[model samples]
Target: MKKIIPYIFLISVVSCQYFEKEVPSEQELMEKQMKEINWKEVDEYPSVADCEAISDETLRKQCFFEFLASTIQQKLSVDTLSVLYPELDTIEVRVTINPDASMQFEPQFPKDTVAYDTIKIDSILRVKLVDFPKVNPAIKRGIPVKTQFVLPVIIKTEK
Candidate 1:
């Protein structure tokens, strides 16, 4: 009876699954990892030389905008149009900064200001932008990312 009891116990223990947990498949594991990641926001922002000094996120963002504006303003010659088109007050420049820091842009001017030649404006902006310094692009999960900005350049009227 004792030998039979020991044999029964051994059989019961061996038959019972010690580790019942199912091992996840590679595809399942990968899908789970992907779901864990947050894809909406970048971990780091695109930064210029001047903006790098700022530590605060909001302030750094502001500095970045200001830096780009100042750089573009320096190269852009608004005076050329002032004499010909005094009515034009602003130009909205749409810029896309690629992951590699290269830029592409389109300028939008008011339709009412027909006297202002758009080709001339585009040429001037394109040339000036070519000289713009390469900036560090935004990053997400250690990968460089592209970003876009719309900047309104106010035409300074001589007072």
Candidate 2:
């Protein structure tokens, strides 16, 4: 019985050590507070010079709004979806160009970014959809919502 008593006491001491709780360090607390204080900036819309360049009044207006909407959607997608659903393999984007006009899409990722994919601009200058697996869910939801922008292409003069 005496031997068992010592063993029990030792066991209790070892178990207590294993159950010790961890306290947050001052540096960690400061970092957390800083993160909470930092505010994210709101995105800006395209400038007026962008609007004036569109030769077709109607297309210009449509394009102007569309561009702004698209930018917002892209930002949201990157911010929300990427964190929530990593399994989402890809995102698709569609572009449409008028019969008399030609257009191209330029996708830019960060400098250190490793993912590489080719964007094919349709012969008719319309993109049906683009799929980006790395996109954020917030931005993905915005994809269906479209903003119209005006196209600045001038009419051709034929003799």
Per-model TM-score on C-alpha atoms: 0.73, 0.22
Point out where model 2 deviates above 4 Å.
30-159
Provide the global lDDT of candidate 1 against the true structure. 0.80
Tens-place lDDT per residue, model 1, 1-159, is 988999999988887786567899999999999998877777887888878888998898888888877777766654465556678667789878899888887887777867778988888778766768878898888989987779987666676
**Can you give the lDDT of residue 133 in candidate 1?**
83
Model 2: how far is 97 from its true place, Å?
Answer: 28
Scored against the true structure, residue 140 in model 2 reaches a CA lDDT of 17
Candidate 1 positional error at 121, Å: 2.3
**lDDT scores for all predictions?**
0.80, 0.40
lDDT of 2 by residue, 4-80 (tens): 99999999998997889898999999899877652332122222345656777567556655654455355434343
- Candidate that scores best on lDDT: 1
TM-score of candidate 1 versus the correct structure, residues matched by position = 0.73
